[model samples]
Target chain A: MRSVLCYGYGNPGRQDDGLGVALVEQLETWAMAEKIPGLTFDSNYQLNAEDALAIAGHDLVIFADATGEGADAFAFRRLVPHATIAFSTHAMAPESVLALCAELYGKQPPTWLLTIRGSAWEPNGALPAAAQANLAAAVVFLKEWLRRPPAAV
Target chain B: MNPEAEKVFNAGAARANAAYAGQRRNVTINPITRLEGHGKIDIFLDGKGDVERAYLQVPELRGFEVFSLGRPAEDMPQITSRICGVCPTAHHMAATKALDSLYQVEPTSAGKKIRELVYNAFTLEDHALHVFVLGGPDFIVGPEAPPELRNIVGVIGKVGLEAGKKVISMRRRVREITSYFGGKVVHPVLGLPGGVSKALKAEDLPKFKELATAGVEFAEWTLGVFKSIVLGNPEYVKMITSDAYTHKTCYMGTVDANNNVNFYDGVTRVVDCNGKEVCKFTAKQYRDFIAEHTEPWSYMKFTFLKDRGWNGFAEGPESSIYSVGPLARLNAADGMATPKAQAAYEEFYNTLGGKPVHHTLANHWARVIEMIYAAERIEQLVNDPEITSPDVRRIPTALPTEGMGIVEAPRGTLFHHYQTDVNGLITMANMVVATGNNAARIAMSIDRAAKGLIKGGHVTEGLLNKVEMAFRAYDPCLGCATHTLPGHMPLRARIYNQSREIVQELVQD
Candidate 1:
């Protein structure tokens, strides 16, 4: 069985920014009910250097985050190890994480980014109706995507 | 859209632009990336193009205190931690300590030790991140190097792949110790009212002991790396002691009974520019010593010494403006509590020309010394017999009222204050984050660097980086300083001519 790691990061306290983690939560529940094998779930407020090691251990990884940019409700794209200078210690781009993994751990597992559209970012505000719709659509698409064989993915 | 209305709008915009073109030129470093949150530096230039006044603005603000109102006081530890992903543990520990003060209950000896152990481990890792990644490019990879050669990748190239791997491994192990207790390093759930939610198990002691030992070794090696790479280069040392980065402001930090630097708990100590003790106060008495001064130009409130008063951005013995963080902490305390760190402290002072080194760039060296202290402290705490004791909490019976808690975060001193009603619901909440405490001094640093570097309207990428180096040494976390979302923003610097027309633009991704 191929080991797959699903990592989502964003501040849940912020209204629409929580879409990434919210999707992971729903995905985890569905995956558990289906008794999916070799699939792991993790989350945090944002991505950091330590996450490189986490992705290195898996055969496949998916990084989920909410994006203020993009016209579509959700977009998924394959990731390559690309090193970019990070501005802050608080967070790092998904590509940078993959780059760090390749450099430090000598492993560049197949990776993908799932960006869901978000609008509001107010503190303590609930997810807006539009963001919820985007999240649901992303979740449905992800469930189908995850069911595919590792080689095909 | 009507054509006549469009014409009218265009004419109005032209008039406004023409008016702005006649005004004094301004140089703005917007969205200063690579640090937490969004920061912008605006340097207003005189007619000759020399800097007149510079302001550092934090545009994004979250209503954290307002959000805390009407919530249960017990929820603060969790809620406040969510404010910044970079320093969640600092907020968690501060809020936990505040809860102890609110309930008027002391944590069991074991619980206090556990908290200390976890805190030191966090400091070691966080400081490592800054030293190896965030601040590394400036010194480690050489400030004069090209932008592409001045990042973590560059540091790896200079230090070799093995060293890079070691840093990742060491940070992973150190954070493991934090996650073991807090349940998660990002948003820890360990702190309770009087104690921790869980106690350290005996079986886990061996692994912690091993990790602590490895952490100390790693820190010692890091100190050696700094000694060779940063301290060995005379140019780097000259830059560190340069006048543009020097400040004569007061310093503040927490210290133990022996006047040694402490991160977890101690009396707050304040020292003047000459390194003489100004005052010592408890967490509850912070208001008597420190006050926040507001300016209409920025969202951040500058913290100053209350007795001396707010005397603007001037730096001297009489100036109320003070700084916190590694260098300040070292200057405020007599020595480090641990032996190896104490020797390092002596070397740092001797090499830098005695107590209270005034150079801002010296903060990078001071931070490395702190790593030694944190690692040694972690080793001491984990080996104590009381570490494994299960008596971690005491029931609180006292009524909730007003309480305050303070901790030395990796960046600087952090304070959490709360007032609760009879039902234990929060009435008011306030926090004095490290970046806010250093805001005034940071503004002065930026202004001074801009004046020294940019002359005759010439702003080079290297020069602007030097200006940024002044504040980057502080490792200011604007995300934690203000309650804002932690997101990455590109760095852009725009210079407006005397007529307020765009003269030059520089952008970095």
Candidate 2:
């Protein structure tokens, strides 16, 4: 079975760390509007190496997480599994877990981590103007990704 | 890098160990997750048989107190609820109570019942999350289990699918009840100065009863599973009951006139293990009894019982008293009033004794027992005809110059004190978070457990995970604990210490 699992990873309490959740929320809106099919979504603040085991059986796994890199409010990059560590901001980077899964299970899903650049992560729950700009960009990307069938490796 | 080699470099091994007598070996977890804000765990090992020192560091420096300087007193609960999502209701109630205290306004008879019902709903929701989501895995998956299996999904996989579904269903009930009362689970905005923002509707009572009744059954089944799987095991029982790291400290919490566990508007009481009352005071009197200390590296504050002051690593439980959430609250109370809670209370007291439970491992068991209490309390509240009344909220007409709110969050007792000027703008604010209450205690427990488990600086990943899981037993929401993470380090430790003390003192992030 070709399973599609989508995740939104970011610290929700942190202002724009909420982007991943917000992006997923926005995608839910888009999914309804554009009628995307064969997709299931789960949003978590962070998923460590061990937690990734739950994503088993997925053929196409789309991981969306927050990134501290802010050349742009948000940028769309099709990340290879290894690229996740460079941009991922979590306890156990998505790449590290994906690597572990590959080593243990002989294979991993065709994984791509989509990072929505975050600007606000201060103590105060303040969202920056640039982070707000990414909301639309993230939603647009999700809509496009959903509009097509899963790309096999 | 290899951990052993890294440890040699970090510890300074033979040279520093032999030469520097005054130097101490320390390990610090810079960021502790699932807590209110920011804090760390520091372990000072003399590399000897005993734990040289264990400090749970809470160094909140963003000054929510100062941040609230210009906000309205009426909005204290809402603002403070952002202090933590897990215990938003605790802050909300505490803020409301503080406001009422400042205004010297007590809720009417109906308002009292409404507050109680709402408080019950809040506790049930908070406690359920901890039981099913946070603490459940340890018991269900077994403490020595693999890291990948140490979570809710693991619990579901190990236990029957039906049992897992029951936990989820009960959690949904809890969320539903809280949502019905508070509008949403993320940040509740229901409480006001004198009472809640909204009252229970007629339809809410029956629906609530149905959900709560189902929850009661679920809790019982879950507890049965926990009893067989966790508490029943000889090793688990020994670990929890052993005196190896038992920290005996004074227990403080709110209790009603009859000495029953109360979440809102109760006399603040502290009792010893023998159930002797050490002190009796009001929530407003906390400042007189509690003082906060800060570590340089952490953004969380360590609050100690004022009289005891700071007890440096004397070892055992006495030197490291810790508290918060239902276990502490239960230990502080003489008896439970809610029928199910009372019955469970009798059993728990008989088993554990009538004092503060010192075993951090038991925290998971205590949490599940409280889940029973929360579920039962919900049933009682929903069955009461008053719960159905539409008079759920009573808006405050004026803001008080000063207010203090205190409610038992899922983790423990939470207090929010706010001071406002004549213009009703907040001048000062302070939050005694639930996790903060047990900060010292958790550190001590982990230190003792680590010392007992770790031989000659050797520890299995499973042991390390258990130490971490012990902290999870509190179900801390570090989001509220370290609100000032992205900011500059609070302070550097001291001279002779190349490393920051706070960084060395707190649990791992």
Candidate 3:
């Protein structure tokens, strides 16, 4: 079985921005109930340089995050190692993490980005209905997507 | 916005427009990336195209105090940690300390040791991130390097792949120590009122000791790297001590009883421009020493010394504005508590000319020295017999009222204050984050760099990178500095002519 790592990142305290983390919670539960093997989960408020190590050890990696701009409910796309200048130490783009992994560890696990369209982002606010719908749709899609062969994904 | 704020905004805009009446130009660097959250830089030029004024504006996260209202005071450690994705541990520890103060109880020796251990581990890893990944590129790859070549990958390219692996390996090992005690490295669940939730297990002691040893070694290696890469370069050293980055201002940081820098706990100490001790105050007495100044154009509130008073954004001893963070911590203290760190600290001051190093770029060096202190401190704490003792909690019994906590966060001094009712529910909350404390000084640095580098309408990417380096040295984390609704802002630069017409606009998304 191919090892799969699902990492969700965003500030959960910020309303709809929590979709990625919330989705991971549901996915973990679903995966466990289905007794799916070779699947691992992790999350944080944001991604950092250390995540490069975590991703390198996995056969496949999926990064889920909330997006303010996107027309679809969710967008799943392949990721390639690309280094971008980040202005803050607080977070790093997933692509940057991949780039670091390739640079330091000489490993580039096939990676994908799952962006769930989110509207509300108020701190300590509840997730809006629209965001909830988008998250549900993304979760459904990811469930099927995860079941596919590693190469197909 | 309130009437006063609106008035200030109008007045600022009017002043800028009037200054631009003689064919001046405006350069706006919107949404600075990387450190934490969003920040922007606005530069106005005179008729001759020399920089007239430059302002750094950051967005503030709203309603955090209101959000904490009526919540249990004990929840602050968790709730406040969630305020920012970065530096959650700093907020966690500060809030946890506040809870201890609120309940009028102190943690058992073991509990305190455990807290310090985790905290030091955190500082080591966090500083490593800045040195090797975030701010390191400015020096490691050279500031004049192309934008694409000034990142972690570029640092690895310059420093070699093995050194890159060492940094990654060291961070992972250090953070493992954090995860062992804190439960999660990002959002820790370790701190409790008057104690930590878990005691260090005997079996975990050996592993922790090993990590601590590695941490110290890693820090020393990093210092060597910095010396060879930054200090060895004459141009870099000159730039570090240049007039553009230098500021003679008061400094603030946490210090031990002996006046040595302490990250987890200490009394707040302030030093004047000439490195003279200004005052020392407890966390509760912070208000008597510090005050915030608001500007209409930015959400960040600039902090200043209350005794000296607010003197605009000007530096020097006359101005009330003071800086915090690594360099400030070193300046405010007598020396590092750890032996190796003390040596590194001495070398830092000696190489930089003397005490109270005013150059902003020197912050990077001070940060490396701090990593040594943090690592050695970690080694000391882990070896203490009480580190694994089970007597952790000293159960709080005092009635809830008011409390305050302070810590030297990686960026600078962090303060957490809370007022609670008899029910131990929060009635009010206030946090003076590190970035907020340095905001005014950061503004001054940006302004000075713009004036010094942007001469006669000539602005190169290299010049802009150097300008950004001024603030980046402080390792500002605006995400933690200001509480705002969540969203990403696009990076853009807009240039306007004397007529206020947009001559050119560049956007990065």
Best by TM-score: 3
Interface RMSD of each: 4.2, 9.6, 4.7
The collision pairs in model 3 are A86-B34, A87-B33, A87-B34, A87-B35, A88-B34, A88-B35, B61-B483, B61-B484
Model 2 regions more than 4 Å off: A1-13, A21-65, A69-114, A143-153, B1-51, B54-63, B102-104, B108-115, B294-300, B311-322, B353-356, B481-509
The 10 consecutive residues of candidate 2 chain B with the worst lDDT sum are B487-496
Window of ten residues with lowest summed lDDT in model 3 chain B = B481-490
DockQ of each: 0.40, 0.11, 0.47
Q: What tens digits encode model 3's per-residue C-alpha lDDT throughout B208-270? A: 889889899999999999999988999998899999998888999999999999999989999
Cα error, residue B407 of model 2, in Å, equals: 0.5
Location of the lowest summed lDDT over 10 successive residues in candidate 1 chain B = B27-36
Rank candidates by DockQ, best first: 3, 1, 2
Q: Which regions of candidate 1 fall more than 4 Å away from where they truly are?
A: A149-152, B1-37, B60-62, B480-487
lDDT of 2 by residue, B1-509 (tens): 14554454334433333323333343233343322233344444543423343344443434456557787777677666655534556777778788887666776555667677677766665565555545665666676766566544565567765665455445545666656667743346667666666677675466767887887887677667777887677887787777654666667778889988877668877765445676777777888877776543344566776776765323333432546666667777888767766777677667766456766667677776777776777677667777666654445566467667677776777877777787788888878777777766665576566556655444455665555555666666554421222211121121122222321222222
Candidate 3 regions off by >4 Å? A150-153, B1-14, B17-38, B480-491, B495-509
User: Which lDDT tens digits does candidate 1 get at residues B361-438?
Assistant: 999999999999999999999889999999988888999998899999998999999999999999999999988899
- Candidate 3 CAPRI category: acceptable
TM-score of chain B of 3: 0.92
Clashing pairs in 1: A87-B34, A87-B35, A88-B34, B21-B499
**What's the true lDDT of residue B89 in model 3?**
88
